[model samples]
Target: MMMRIIYPILGMVMAFTSVLHAQSARITALPLQKELKLPASFETAVEKIQYDLLENENGESRIEVVDENCLHIQFIFSTDKAVKQDDWQVSVTPAFSPSFHWAPHLTPTDRHIIDQHVFRSPALIMADGRQVITLIPDLDIMKKGTPVRWYLDLDAEGNRLVLGMSNSRVDDHVLFVREPGAEYPAGEVEIGFYLMVNRDEPSLKNPFRRPLEFLWKRWGHGLYQDGNPVDADLERYVEHTYNWAFNSWAENVWQEFELNGNKVGAPVFIVNYTQSPNYPGEVNEREFRSVWNQAWFSSLRSAGGLYRYAKRTGNTDLMEKALLTKELALSFPQVEGFFYGLIGTEMHEVEIDGKKYNRSKGWDTHYWGNSNRNPYTWNAAESPFHILDMSWTALLMLRWYDELEKDERLLRYAEQYAGSLLGIQSESGFFPGWLDLHTLQPMAHLNESPETSMSATFLLKLYELTGKQEYKEVGLKAIDAIIRDVIPSGRWEDFETYWSCSRYGSDYLVGKKVARNDMYKQNNFSMFWTAEALLESYRLTGDRRYLEWGQRTLDEMLMTQASWQPPYMYVNVLGGFGVLNADGEWNDSRQSLFSELILQYGKLLDSDEYNERGWAALKASFVMMYSPLNPVTKAQWEKVYPFFGKEDYGFMMENYGHGGRTNAEGEGMGEFTIYDWGNGAAAEAYNRILDKFGKIK
Candidate 1:
C-alpha cells in the first residue's frame, strides 16, 4: 500500500519536472547594456544567479529576466526525483547601487530576514532623494497557508529583497520554524517577481495598495466578521476598555514609591511586561518603567483617557485616578537656567516598597529580552534632556488645563516651558532635538528633526489659549522652517524615540561612538506628527500649501500600515502597523491614533474617502481587544494566547507578532505582555472618538 502511494507521487513529481524542463527551453538571461547606463545592482545583468531544485541533488533551473520600465524575473524549478515539498521559500535579493541609498526605517543595522509583522512594505524601497526603486514580490506566490516573511539584506556585498514561505505548523507566537516532513505531492514550483524604478514624486500615493485589496477580497474587510460588524457597540467597547485599564492599574500597574521622603502610590505606565503580567524583574535592581517620559506613553496621556472616560460614565473614583496621574506627571523634577521651565527628561530616584528603583535611571532597559540590559549604561540620569518629550508633555498638560481645570500651576508650567522654547529658537526657526542637562546647548542632532518641530503645534495651541503673540510668531516661524528645510529632504521621520543614537554632528551614540546615521529613523509616527502640525498650521492661517503638505505626510503614514492579511487564523494583520522599520512585527497601540488623525483630516478637508478610511481605522483599533463581547477576536485571541482568563478580557498585548515570540516564554504570533501605550492609547483614542463621533455604534 505504501509502495503504491509512493509510486504515484513519484510519477506526479517526474511528470511536473519534465513539463517544466520542456517549457524552460526558450528562457534566457538578458545581457547587460552599458549604453543604457543600467545599474550595476541588477542581479540578472551582473551575476549568474541560479537555484537547485532537488535536495542533495543538482537539477536544471531556468531563469528569465524581462527588461523594460521594470525588471521582471521568472523562474521554474525542475527536479529529477519524485520529492514532495510542504515547506519552501523563494527569495529575491537586489544589489544596491552606490547612487541609490537605502531609506532609513529604524530597523537594526544588522537585520536581514524580516517577519510580516515588521515588514514595512511588499516592496524593498530604496531612494536617493530623487529616484525610488521598489522590488516587490508577486502576491500570488506569497499567498501560502503560512504567513509570509520578507528578506531584506543591505550591505557592501549588495542588497537583497526576498520573500519566503514560513512553516505552517507553528506554536503560539512562533515565527520561523521548519517541520521535518513534506506534505505537497511534488517539489516542483514556479516563482516570479518584479523591480520598478521610478522618480520620487511629491504627490505619490501608496503604490502598494494592491495587497490590501487582495486581502480585503480574501478575508472580506478586516472590520467584518461573517459580513457582520465587529465594533458595533463603540460606547460599550469604550467603557469596557476603561474598565480594563482601571482594573489593570488596580491589579498590576500601580507603583508605590517614596518620593522626596513621602510615600506616594500612583498608576504608573510601564513600557512593557515580559517575565509576568505583574511587575517585571529587575535590571541592575532598577525596575523597568516608562516613568515621566514621552507624552504619548506617559501617565499624563493615560490621565487624559481616564478623565474623559470618567466624565462620560460619571465615575468619580476613575476621575480621582485621573487627577492622580496628572499630579504624578507634574511631580517630576524640573530644570533651571538655560533650560529653565522645562521638565528634565531624567529618571528620578524613588524608593519602591522600601527598595530604591530608578537609582541609575534605566527604565525599559531589559524588559522584553531586549539587549540594552545594564542600568549603568546609557542611563537617562546622564543623558541630555529631550525637548520634544518635555514640550509634548507640557502641551498635554496645558490641554487638560484649558478643557477641564484652569489650574494656576498648569498655566505657570506652560508659560515657563513656552518661555524657554522662545529663548532657544534659532535664526532658522528650528528647535534642537535634545538639550544638554546643565549647559543647555543642543546635545543630540544639530539638524532640525520633523519630530521635534511638532512642538510648534503646542505653541500654536498656547497662543490660542493665552493670546500670546510671541508664541504665535515663533510657532509660525517653525512651520515655515519645516516647509523650507525639512520638506525638501523628504526625511520626515520620527527620531525622538532613540535620543541616544539619533545624533547628527557628533559620533556619540548610546555609549559607543558611531557615525551620524547610526540609529536610523524610528517609525511612521513622525509622518502623522508632521501632518498634525501642518494641518494645525493650515487651520490657523488657512494656508493651502500647509494643507497639501499635511495630506502628503498623512498619505506617507498610511503606507506604513499592513495592507495585506497574512494567511493566519490566529492573528489579524490588516490595518495593523509594524513596531519599527523592517523590525518585523505589528501592534495595535497606534490604531486609534491613526484613526483620529484620519478622521481629523477628513473633517477638516470634508473628504468622504478619508472619512471612510477613518471609520475603518477606528474599527481596526479595537479589533485586537480580548473582550468576550468580540466573539470572533475573543476565540482567535484564545488560539494564540490561551493564558488569558475571564479577567483578562479587556486586556491587549503589546505586540501582534507576524512570527516573532509573543513574550519571553511563548513562541507565537501575539504576545501576552500588556503595555500602557498599547491598551492605554486605545482607551484614550476611543474616548476621544466617542466625544467627536458620539457613539459610533
Candidate 2:
C-alpha cells in the first residue's frame, strides 16, 4: 500500500488540461478552483498531494464514476515537530441555492452548522438542477485503518463548505473541531477522496444509489430471518394486535357529560399508556391513565387502526367506535380564528379513577426522554405548533371523508388545517418544523429543515381528493423545495417527536439565548415520512423525477437500519433500526411506519423488486413485539431483561438498546416508555397492511 501511494504523485506538478469532444469532456489533472481555507498549522506541516483519475471507463472500481467526471486525490502528511496545536479544517464554496449540509442557501442560520457528519453525503447541486457534484471520502482509507475522524463542515454563511479529516467530531449535535493540544501526526498519513459529477435530471439515474444498494445486498439482506419466532407470523401478530385493540385498548362513547371537569359532547378515545413495570426505570403512576391533546398519542393513530379493522371485518359496531375515535381526536384544544387549525402540541392531564394525572410529566427523566422536548407551555402563542400534528390530523380527516363519509364537516376541518399551513409556508415552499401558534412565525432555526415533507404529504393528499388547484400548486412547490434542497445533501433533520424543543419554547419566544437542541439529525422516521410524501407527489402527478428522488432517499434511510445483528445479548435485532447516527443499533419505534411506506412505494411503482424488499421490512417490524407464541424470543428477552416474563400483546418495545447511546450503552432489551408512538403506531401500520394486502400470510 505504501509503494502504491508513491506512483500517483510522480507527476503531481503536471499542468491541468481539459479534453473536450462533441459529446464528452474530461479533466486530466484537477485544479483547486475554490479558495479553500485550511489551518495554518496544517499548511505549515510538511505534506505532498497526489491527483489522478480514480476510475474512468474501466479501472479498479471502488466506486462508480462517469468516465469523464471522475477524479482521485490523495493528501500525504509528514509531521509538525514544533508541537504547536490548532483546530484543523478545510473549506470550499458551494455554487448552489438551497444547499443542504452546506450552509442553507435560502434560510441561513446557526442550525445548519450543527448537523455536520461523516454520513451527510456532501454534495452541491448546480442552480440549473440538472447536474450534481458529490464529494465522497474513501471510508476504508479515512477511518477504518487510520486514526482520522473525518467530518463535514458548513459555516452559517452559504459561501463555505468543509470536509474535515482532523480535529473534528460532531458530539451531541454540536460541531467540536477544537481539541486541546491537537497537532499533526508523527508518521506518514494518506487521505483520499473521490469527486464525481453526474447528471441530476429526472431521466438519469441517481449516482448516490449505487453504494447504498451494494450495502443492502451485501449485508442488509442476509441479516433478516425468514421465519423468526418473533412477529414474522404476521397472521397471528395482526390477529393478536387487533384483539388487544378491540378488547383492552378501545374506549366507548357515552352521552355528553362532565367527565374529568371537561365537557365531552363527543366520544373520547384513549391512546396513552403507562411505562411497563417490567422495563427499567421508576415507572410513572400517571402514565397508566390516558392523556389528551397529543395528536399521535391521544387518538389519531389508534383511530386509523380501528377504522381499518372495521373496514376489513365489516363490524358496524367497531366502525362506529372508529368514527368516534376520530371525532375525539378532532375535538382536541385548537387555536381559534387566525390560527384556527393549529392544535395543542402539549399534553393535558386527564382524570382517571377520580384523580388527575399528567402522563408525560416525568418522562424527561428517562434516557429516551432526552429526544422529547418536554415541559412545554399551553399558551397558543408561545407554544410551538408541531406541523406533523396538524398534518396527520388533517390527513386522517381527508381520508375518512373520502373513504368512509362525504361529511362536509370533515372537508371543512381539512381545509382549515391545510389552509393554515399555506399561510405560514416559507418563500421556499416548505413549512417550518415548529411555528408560534399565535404569530405563525418560525420557532428557532427550523424554517429550513427538509422533513417538512410531512406537511406537503397532507396537502397533496387533499389535492388528490378534491382536485383543488391551490392545494396542487402549493404541494408541488414543496416537492420542488425537497428535490432542490434535500436530495443534494441528505440533511434529514428536524423530524423529532412532537414535543421536542418544548423545554426551550419560552426562550425561543422571548429572544433569549437557547442551545441548538431542536435539530434531530439523521432521524429515520423523518426520512421514511419524507419518502412517503415524495411517492405521493409522484402518484398525483405521474412524475418519474419524484419517484427517482424518493428511491434515493429510501436508500439513504436504509443506512439507519441494522444490516446485521450485533453480537449483543438478549432479543433478535437483525431487522431493527437505530435512531440518528447509531447505524448498528437495532429497533426503533418507527419500524411499522417504515414497513408501511416501503410497501406503498412497491405497490405504486408496480415494482416487484421493491415489493420483495418491502415485505422483508414488514417482517422486520414485528421482531420487537413480545409474543407468547414466540417463546424463543420471549425467553431470550427474559434472559437479558427479565422484564418480558410478563407478556403484553399490544406493547412493542420502542428501542431494544442493542447498540447506541439511545440507552445505557445498549445494555438492556428495551427502553422505558410503551407510549402511543410505538404501540399505537405499530397497530396503525399493521392495520394499514392488513387492509391493503389482506391476511399477511
Candidate number with greatest TM-score: 1
Which digits, one per residue and each the tens of the lDDT, describe model 1 over residues 458-530? 8998998888788888998887887786554445544433432222212333222112223233446666777
lDDT of 1: 0.52
Clashes of each: 16, 2
TM-score of 2: 0.62
- TM-scores for all candidates: the values are 0.70, 0.62
lDDT of model 2 at residue 657?
A: 45
**Which run of 10 residues does model 1 get worst, by summed lDDT?**
1-10
RMSD of each: 9.3, 10.7
